[model samples]
Target chain A: MSAPHSATSANGVPTLDVARLREDFPILGQQINGRPLVYLDNAATSQKPVAVIDAIARYYREDNSNVHRGVHALSERATAAYEAARETVRGFLNAASSKEIIFTRGTTEAINLVAQAWGRSTLQPGDEVLITHMEHHSNIVPWQMVCEQTGATLRVAPINERGEVIMDEFERLLGERTKLVAVGHVSNALGTINPVARMIELAHAHEALALVDGAQATPHMVVDVQALGADFYALSGHKMFGPTGIGVLYGREALLDAMPPWQGGGDMIKAVSFEGTLYSDLPYKFEAGTPHIAGGVGLGAAVDYLAGVGREAIAAYEAELLAYTEARLQEVDGLRLIGTAENKAAVASFVLEGVHAHDLGTIVDHHGVAIRAGHHCAMPVMEFFGVAATSRASLAFYNTREEIDALVTALQDAQRIFG
Target chain B: MDLRDLYQDIIVDHNRSPRNFRRIDNATRMAQGYNPLCGDKLVIYITLKDGAISDVSFQGEGCAISTASASLMTEVLKGKTEAEAEALFDNMHRLLTEDAHGVDVDELGKLAALEGVRAYPTRVKCATLCWHTLQAALEEVDEPVTTE
Candidate 1:
């Protein structure tokens, strides 16, 4: 978790000392199937660094208590750490104020919050919610539910063969009725980095609010919600090497102030009178019940860990590694890489001609190479590609070229066995 | 565990060229099976003659294990009595779930080829989907069975 001691490669892009950095993650050192584990499933959920793990343990050991109610010392300490975790998350997204950052279960809950709270209040009958085809199920389903409840039509923008959003179609879908435009900053299944800044601007131009699903974006790239001019942004901590069951939702303060609380619980209420209940202010208003305090603390530690590694440096290193992986994957005959987007991030999804992805998954696991092989919760993306499933090797900053080579070897073994 | 144990030559051969990989157009009973985890789908068809299965075949798309499982199940279940197929289904289920101490592997015959799936817990559903579908068809369960 110390500063990234990664030496810069030629041409001045900072290349991480992945060898040394890998040492920080204990899980990476272990072996699977008698061979060293080659984890290429970062897009599924990243392996947590020791710092995040230690943070969770330390919270439970020292500051474990309910937040915001008790006057006891443990309560004060726990509340401080939990709120400080909120500030760290605010800084992670570069939001203007911590008040805009609401802690949720994960991106799915974050999206659902906006869909129910904002969509229910604002969406009128015949209003539209526009989204892209490459969105994860998390982003798509909430909007569909809201649309169904409010009698608003759900519109989908198509993506090209390369998995890039068809901007023209996206623009065409945007009109007077478009109430909310939700899109993923990066496609989880394809790793296509959408032009979200422009998309947000277009949504604003159409008088519609835009929300960016940053679950797949925060791990690999630096995100500034203000710079993107997004109305709402959502991110998952687990996908960024933090603990599971915790995430952040960053809404513009004005929008959050106007939207009603999504859930009612102990923390979210300021006063519960016999006559009526007065809701708490921004952030806490939407966070119902006791928050995931330990999760938040671990997420804070994960943010610190990423900062020390440097997001720009991690991006450059992983980009180089992704290129290496794509090229090496092409070495296997009958292997067809899906999602050949011009602008891509940490994922490489593909299908072998003769082998079903499920069979291929089993084949590679024997070699200690763990890659995700399924719909990736993006069934529409699978449908678009005309595949039942795909074998995806989603890289991380810690993954090595050697690991990718091992993956290729294992893939060849699959071909040999099935050939 | 060695990959060969799971992807044995027989399993691979059956996957490459599956037996009974056809639809019985005159089928008397049919049932669908789905494994949502891997998106494996298998449809089992059985034509009964005198309350006994006279013709059997399968049609569907799934992973190697599921495809080979369906192919093998159809081949073995042809002309089997309804009760006989049900007993075999129970045996196949036990073979996949039990440890070495529990089930008799020698009696399983070609179904023994699937015992390796015990090592890969996630793949057990793949090997069982066909058997479940065949069981459903025998009972004439109209709804599709899912290996959740």
Candidate 2:
């Protein structure tokens, strides 16, 4: 196959017009603290476009009905809309079938599903579950729960100072006793894009299953589940410009077919008697009750919006923005940039001497530059860096170089004030 | 009314050159407090003589508010009796959470500078981390308490 073109359009036109994209997201146009909003918190949650919001609004206005079992016309329409969302997500991830995709609350719930269902069933008392040091709390906590419940052991693969996963150490950690390998496709705190394909192959070599936390990666990069050889993949829709409360978990059909249902309530049952109940098959088996219908539809709309802009184009544009942001931030005095990985998304985690991150964030916000402060939910990463917290500015494709300049200027002001 | 007022000249001075910022050679009571959320680790050592705070000191690594709070706390509590220190600490806690419509701070002493922190909801933990640590030390509580 020819090298995949990274430009916006098939005809080489820009996929997302920076100005037009800004218009699509109404939140981007608002003013915060008397300054125009410069949103650099995309790693937390990208701003939703009018298309996604309207899609959700239209769902509740017109097609508001319970799905799966309803025989009425509204129910049929709602069911089709919901199932169509599954197909959209399946296509988005390039999964083999829609049955392979299960919708959960978010990446956290999806990971818990795999850990409780597959992990609890497969992992023995002495088996080891390996994860990297840079994993989010969601990925780490569920595996820890599995380990605690099953008498299994948890092993951590270390990362270098640059926040890149040490592949050699990860390979060394994988042994015959390793039953599962859970790793993130990208580090949320550091923005390091991990070599997950290699990590998955290593897990396979040890006869273990690999679950990729794509919460941070799916929005920034093109993800093909088959190409990555990921046995299981979990992603939050909100991170990918979709609505919150809707996420996707893609499991290989055979693997999902073999595992037991994670939760039991309304919809995940085929037959129920006082004696015993037979579970429903595949995706439906995992979805326990009334799903987030409008959220799912909004997620489908998000996929549609992104597909219109094109994934490769977004990736290239974000790469340029990341480079621009790094160069601009490098000019700030007494500023130390964290997570200097060779391969990373558009996240800049930094600390300024004599200025607390909370103070820095507040001062920056006075200029309407929104960045994240605190542990960024990766306390281990903060502890490794020996700082309480660093102010993080994460970008999306919709972000522009002008916004990065705004952030730099804001940081300069913060330094002057806090110094 | 900018929150920057919270990081006042006094707070900055205290943060830059904290009072009693050292390990006590001999301590009557010592307790370590850690804000795992922000990674602010503090070890507070107190020298008490007959229900009076004879000498108090602390050493830790954290943000400006936390370090400055530690310094001010040590400075004010060092020469006071246990009852006086407890009352003052309680007043400081009230200054943080209680509605600041109009509260007199003639009794708060130097802690009045931290009044600006009440405006920003997120930094309350930073201001109170050291105070809570001191409370834990005085009460002889061993369990690590996270202020966040």
Candidate 3:
């Protein structure tokens, strides 16, 4: 496959015009602590572009109504916009059909939907649900809940010191009894890109379904659910420069058709009565009630904006930024970078000598550099690394080398104060 | 908020070398506290003699603020009755959470070092993790305390 036009540079290196891209996000222009804001917490939630924000506001102002309920003009318009958003997300993940895409609150909700709907029905008492040590809490906790409810066992696939998944161990754990394999496409805490495609193949070999938590991966790369052949793929819209409270769950149509509805409410029902109620068809069977209409619209706009920028270009630019960030961070003495994986995204988690992540986070905030300081909702990874917390600077395409320099300077300031 | 105010010398000093930083044997009461946000875990133990806290200690891993707060709490808790310790906890809670303008710094003594925690809303939980565990220990609650 050829690189997108915006991704290719003269020297065969993929590059993005980050300066022009920065103009799209107005929040990046604001000042924090009397300095220009340097947002590097994209893993937490990305700053939305004007197009997405405007799309949401436009929906609320121009077409605010309950979707799929009323036959009126406003409701029809809102329903059209909401359904269009699903089509946009379907294209974003390159799913085979819109029927496979289910709108959810976020990745957490999407995972819960799958766990409760599919896991509860499918898992037996002795069944095992395999997950990695590097998965975010969203992926871990939902399966835990399912296991607790269904009397199934939860197995953990270990990661090496460099934070990459030990695939041999992963395959060893995937036995005939293993019912599901839930893994993150990218580690939010360590930025370790797991070998999920091969892992999925291994799961399929063992007759276990694979669910990819694509929250961290969707923003940084081009994800084709059909190409990956994943049983289920989840994404959070907010992490991909869309509004909060909206996400997508792409499941195989066959799997989705077999799984019962997760929630029973307004839109998920076909014909309801006191005696019985038939569930709706695929996608709607999972998305219950009047959904986050504006959020869906905003996510659709975000998809358009990302496509305009080109996902390949964004991924390439972020890869360069990650390298630049890692090199710059190394210049700071006594700094230890965590998660030294061969394959990584634009996340840099580190700890400075004699400085707590919390202290570093505070000091850096004063310098107007936003970083995530804590376990990054991956405590198992922290325990594995033998640290309480690590300060993380996660990047987006809008971030520049200068912002990384600012982050390094802030770390130096932290060293000066705590040294 | 000034960073110096939060990471005052006393707090930093106590963090470097915490007092009563050990696991107590034959404790009258004990409890575990966990702050899931930052992964701060601490176990608080107290020995009571004739209705007074004869000795107190803690062991765990946490950030500087949490470690120092735990250390300071252990120091002040010794030689105080359960009622007095509870009152002191209330005072510390107010001092750490509320405005320091009207609070008597002299009464707070070394604990005033943690007064800057109120400025960082997120860190307030870190500073108080041990105190909550201490409360749990005093009440003899078997379940672990968590700052969720």
Every candidate's DockQ is 0.84, 0.49, 0.61
Q: Native-vs-model 3 lDDT?
A: 0.91
Q: How much lDDT does each candidate structure score?
A: 0.92, 0.88, 0.91
Instruction: Evaluate candidate 2 and give its CAPRI docking class based on DockQ.
Output: medium
Superior candidate under lDDT, 2 versus 3: 3
Give a tens-digit lDDT track for model 2, residues A1-419: 02222345686745556776677788898998788999999999999988899999999999999999789999999999999999999999999999999999999999999999999998889999999988899989999999999999999999898888888899999999999999999888999999999999999999999999999998998999999999999999999899999999999999999999999988999999999999998789999999999999999999988887778888888888899898988899888999999999978999988788877787888889999988888877887887778999999988998899999999888766666
lDDT of 3 by residue, B1-148 (tens): 5778888888878888999999889999999998777778899999999999999999998888999999999998889999988888888888878877777778777887888899888888888899999999999999889866
Q: Model 1, range A1-419, lDDT digits (tens) per residue?
A: 44655667788888678788888899999888899999999999999999999999999999899999899999999999999999999998889999999999999999999999999999999999999999999999999899889999999999999999999999999999999999999999999999999999999999999999999999999999999999999999999999999999999999999999989989999899899999999888998899999999999999999988889999988898899999998888888989999999999999998999999898898899999999999999999999989999998899999999999999999999998
Q: State the lDDT at B111 in candidate 2.
A: 84
In candidate 1 chain A, where is summed lDDT lowest over 10 consecutive residues? Answer: A1-10
For model 1, give the RMSD to the true fold. Answer: 1.2
Clashes of each: 0, 0, 0
Off by over 4 Å in 1: A1-3, A7-10, B100-107
Residue-level lDDT of model 2, residues B34-116, one tens digit each, is: 88766778989999998999999999888778889889989889778878887887888888888864555888888888988
> For candidate 3, what is the TM-score?
0.94
